[model samples]
Target: MSSNKITLKKIAEIAGVHRSTVDKVIHNRPGVSDAVREKILRILKEKDYQPNFIGRALRNQENRKTIAVVSSRVNSEPYLHQGIQQAVQEVGVFGYDVEYYIFDIEQIDQQIEMLYTLAHQKINGIILQALYDARIPGVVSDLAECGIPVVLLNFDHPGCTDALCYIGQDSRKAGRTAAHLAKAFLHGSGRIAVINGYYEKILNIYDRCSGFTAYLAEIAPAVEIAEIVDSSENAHDLYHAAVDLLRRQQIDCIYATSSGTEGIGKAIGELGLQDRTHIICHDLYPEILRMLREGMVWATLSQDLEKQGYLAFQYLVYYLLKGIDPPSKKILIEVDIRLKENMPET
Candidate 1:
């Protein structure tokens, strides 16, 4: 019915029979009842169908496309990992194969090179989390030159070539939105300190911190911005940094824009400052989600992790197969503000 050739499954729908029944009828397998067989034959003749358009017979003729999912340490972030895994699951059902590739977020250059090296291979598609690097434009160009399509997840790499289609939320805008929510919850007056996992290194963290800082400064100038605590991938380092920072400042509010909330929560609880300070962070990890519902964290900003993974695969598959264009320069997903009343229990 559509411009694309109708599949046998579609024909089966028209005949009101299982696709296998259609297959058995077409191949003369003799499993159908006489009436059903006659009905299928009539429908097949009406459609004038002569062949199975999609099957192992045509598999090799079409490219057995390989989609590469390159992500950060997904194991550390459950929801993000879930999103990536869900996208991987979608690949099998959609007739594409996926190869997962991951690297440490700290090793930005190495991660970029590894992605470029994969371009040298037969991979037709890439799902990437764009990191902070000056060479991303060149890397994007190389992938485009090699006819590989790339879909950016979560983070946006500026100066990317035309071949890059981004399917994740706008990192900076997500940050800004979180800041406004923080202001609303805090009532725009308090000394708030910001906790960012990759302060100077990650674009998403920087943008979120920036948005939070800007909105807080605009409506709540009286509220002092205490020093920003730089979170670590190392648990011990993060706990000590947050604890020591909290010890020195009269921090009445805290905003976290990354997944380093576990250590921060422990440190905050150890200091017994939950009564005085209102804590707000991002992501819906098991710990963070529990903290939000338990009133340990006053609120959290969430982006749809599953939706991100699902859309990332969709864009990469589209470009790799049909060279279909993406809709926008950057896709921005809405930020979710979770309060004690609205937070889900894990």
Candidate 2:
């Protein structure tokens, strides 16, 4: 028989054994003799039989699984949200339901409480955008002890080593790329100011800023960072911060390590500094794209947020349904530099 048409029943007939015995051997269950198990294994190997996990899931409705996606509300970038929506739709076909538990960035207690709630709810897996809090590691450990697997999404915590894998961009490398862009824009030396997004609360933002500063120092020591301002990852706050910085100093470039590019672009436009100050920011918000087209922003870096979201969910599904682990512990998404001329048509 063809390998593609191999089945447990067919294998039982060939081996002169009952289907239940074949099932026990296939699933590594006890009660099967070693001779019979080895014979079944040999046939499986020779036939190259592959289990259809989707079919199994479809047939077993009582074994429906739930995956929890937990994150701070502030980190919901648009593309990331879209990717998660897509994952949710796809997983539903395999009898898996995804539950979202979003909390305010400041509410560490609430985030922690939600994790405890999920633990009791019998969550099979988790996709987390981890906060930079001291208490997170212990909670993640508690979940692992309960046999629930976690896949880190977007932001990662070093303490949560129990997580199956991390799926996101290499923030430091993205920062280094930003530094290269800054040097090229400024012709090797100029004053650049950095606006960080929730710097104290998120580890990735800090990593991005550190990468930018270190790379810039190594490549062009003369390109001074005039100021580094921390702002909420929103346009209004970023606008006020940008306006204050622009009024006090003559900045040649502004590198924003997070969202709120619109505010910086607005400040540069209002002060008539667009001709001199080049603005580089992260992500592709609708307003940011418009800013690029209008020449208010120079370029933006994209961390492929949609792919990050999709993979985080899909990886957990594979792990839970097929007993498959991700290919690596650290899955880094590619960073793309977007300019006005090459921005997506949408």
* Top of the candidates by lDDT: 2
Q: Give the alpha carbon lDDT tens digit for every residue of 1-346 in model 2.
A: 4566988898899889999997766554558887887687667666666535334433444666888888877745456667877876655546677777877778888988988888998689988886798888888889999999989889888878888999998999999999999999889989999999899888889999999999999999989999999998888999999999999999999999888778888888899998998788888778888988888788899988899999988888899888999999999998899998899998
Query: What TM-score does each of the candidates earn?
Result: 0.79, 0.83
The TM-score obtained by model 2 is 0.83
The residue pairs in collision within model 2 are: none
Candidate 1: tens digits of C-alpha lDDT, residues 1-346: 3424667798889888899998866554447886886677666655656524323223422455677877776323345556766655544423466677777766777788788889888887787775678887788788878877777777777777554666666667776776676677677777888887766666778888887788778767777888887775555666787888888988877787777677877888899987887678877778788778768798787788877777777766666557676677576678787888888656
* Candidate 1, pairs of clashing residues: none
lDDT of each: 0.71, 0.84
Please list the residue runs of candidate 2 whose C-alpha ends up more than 4 Å from where it truly belongs after superposition. Answer: 1-58, 75-78
Judging by TM-score against the true structure, name the best candidate.
2
